[model samples]
Target: MVTTRQGVRLLGPGDVDAFLDLARRDPVANVFAMYRARTTRLEPRWLGGEAWGRFHDGELVAACHVGANLVPIESREEDARAFGERALARGRSVSTIVGPTEAVREFWRTVSDSWGRPRDLRWNQPHLVIDGPPTAAPDPGVRRTMRAELDELYPACVAMYTEEVGVSPEVGGRNDLYRTRVAQLVSRGWSFARFDAGRLVFKAEVACATDDAAQIQGVWVPPDRRGEGLAVAGMAAVVELVRAEIAPRVSLYVNEWNEPARRAYARVGFQETTTFSTIMF
Candidate 1:
């Protein structure tokens, strides 16, 4: 187990419950990290990362997931600095620094010299969540995507990814991986969409989920459907369905510049609880 002189220790299977409990402390904010922990608990090989924790008098105070993505949860400056040193020592394995805005920013400050400037720094993402039902009227059409509709939903999924991430899901030659992901979500009833007259109009996915919360991602509406209230209504349906069948709470992070989406989420009863930042390499 990797350990620092200051008592930041790498956690393993034996610490699964504590790791997940730390994540559950802020269920909405830690949904992604909690998802990772739960998955690791069930199948350790699936985590493909190292989890580290900082303790104060034997109580876990902070946690971090370092691998393809570096995510710090409820971390202090000391935790960030220690994680930064460990991550840097392992070389540039992390492709992104993503989590609570302040923690990620502080971690970046410590690792910048070794990690280099990022390709993009998204410093302002509002993390919003809704526990109860949405205020907006739900669209009956927004339901789980079926395997038969995979062919039709692929393009919309690609469009959303390209627009949001600035790169197409098909960037690395074939889109086999992306295709598999969409198909899996559909099969698991995690992909939700509105198909009007057989055309995919709105789409969203429960990207990650644990017992307490679920993180929604890839929310989208076709260009022609923009400003038509499709996103607001469709998402209300998505939220309702997710809450009923998946988790009690649903959360998503939106770019601060996306006013339309911000308003849409607001209409659905989502309120910002925290800010998140992403440093993409």
Candidate 2:
């Protein structure tokens, strides 16, 4: 039997170990890397401040992440229901329980049936892992350089996030939460940029990384720079730097509908491992 509660707390690292012991895992290479990262160092980022979790007989079994709806759970109907209730109580407003294929379907069928949100069971995401070597060579004219200071990096980072998500990075207009978030990421070493013709033209961030694998995210290029292989050059440079510093197994995520991005990742030598789904609400 599974018991769920609102604002539930667990001794993160220990409970995460319990949850990982509860079931079979995501087959995607990137998923495992991210999960391992979270279990070790990324826990504070996802579980800080009044988050949620599920337990069976006082043992942690599953959990729902607070800010980002990246629910990492072992499959169990009772556990799924309990976690869903806690998420709803926390105003998670989502219709997903992503696991392996069958588990994903069951989560959607049971948890969201009467919740009023239309469930999209087929929601899929493709993840790629960098293992041995890069598939495509860097563009000949492409150049890469890292910005040393947050002030030097903020403009490019902000522009890339805005362009990709179609929303501007939060700056002090009224409440400074959004602006502060961008600043926090840079302070934590999460930003990167590339330039051409003296113009800072491309940007991406290391969403999560360890000494071995760095997940590349928010890769964006202005429209005028598209098709010129700037992405190949810029991204290759990022991978090279990270690999030199840590591990060579780089990874990234892309939406299934994002064909252009899929192509770009392929050019960067990423082969998909598995699909994942997420709900914004």
Candidate 3:
């Protein structure tokens, strides 16, 4: 790890333990970073980008994951600024900047001028977590998606992505990559959904997981199925299964303005633990 002028250095295999220690400070909030580090072992060849560490007084205090997504782990304002500067030097390569609200905000402040306008800036996202059984009744009908169901599930995944992100996953010729990701999740038994007469009614996926926690993403109830309480019960089932087989804790973040989704998560027993921010390109 050669130190840079700003005390930020590219992390490698040698820094895995220290990086894990730093990220585990808040496992739910740091699950994405921890998952990446564990799977890639801090190797750039595997990471497809890099993990960066900020050292102070010869100790690793904070770190950032830079790849398709830029995520800061337990970074303070100054530390995030330094990471932002390092990213600026490397040019804008990530599709999104996301993390704890303050750190992401500070990181953006440092790079925004050079990075120019973002497609969207979500300044307030509630980071929620649940460590025990959900209060709502689990929907027994909801189960892990089978690999054979890929052709059936793919369209719903695309719909959810387009509705949530305001763009089709097929845009920019990424259909195959997105489809493969969905298939990978199914193969890992991380994708969950409920179907009625072979038609999908609700869906969600475990975006990442570590021993400590798992993060949920791409939650959706078809527009016609919304308000039918599918999400609440489906999430309850998801939480139950994830804790039983994947991790002890489950987490997810939602846009602050999305009140209905927030209410559904609350009904499923999720509690707000922190705030996150996302700047999407």
Q: Give the TM-score of candidate 1.
A: 0.95
lDDT of 3 at 149: 88
Question: Could you give the C-alpha RMSD of every candidate to the true structure, in order shown?
Answer: 1.5, 5.1, 0.8
Return the number of clashes found in candidate 2: 3
lDDT of 1 by residue, 187-239 (tens): 98999998989999999999999888999999999998799999999999999
lDDT of 3 by residue, 1-281 (tens): 57888899989999999999999899889999999999999999999899999999889999999999999999999999999889888999999999999999999989989998999999999999999999999999999999888988999999999998888999989999999999999999999999999999999999999999999999999898899999999999999999999999999999999999999999999999999999999
- Judge candidate 2 against the unseen true structure and give its global Cα lDDT, from 0 to 1: 0.56
Pick by lDDT: 2 or 3, better one: 3
| Pairs of colliding residues, candidate 1 | none
RMSD of 1: 1.5
Local distance difference test, candidate 1? 0.88
| Model number with the top lDDT | 3
Best by TM-score: 3
Winner on TM-score between 2 and 3 is 3
TM-score of 2: 0.70
lDDT of 2 by residue, 1-281 (tens): 22324323543554554544442343233344344535453365544432346655676555544333445455455655555555455554442344434335544555554455543433677767777656666544433333344454566666776655555656346226655665665565565566555576666666666545667777877778788777776777666665665466777766677787778788877787766555432
Query: Given candidate 3, what's the lDDT at residue 172?
Result: 89
Give the higher-lDDT candidate: 1 or 2.
1
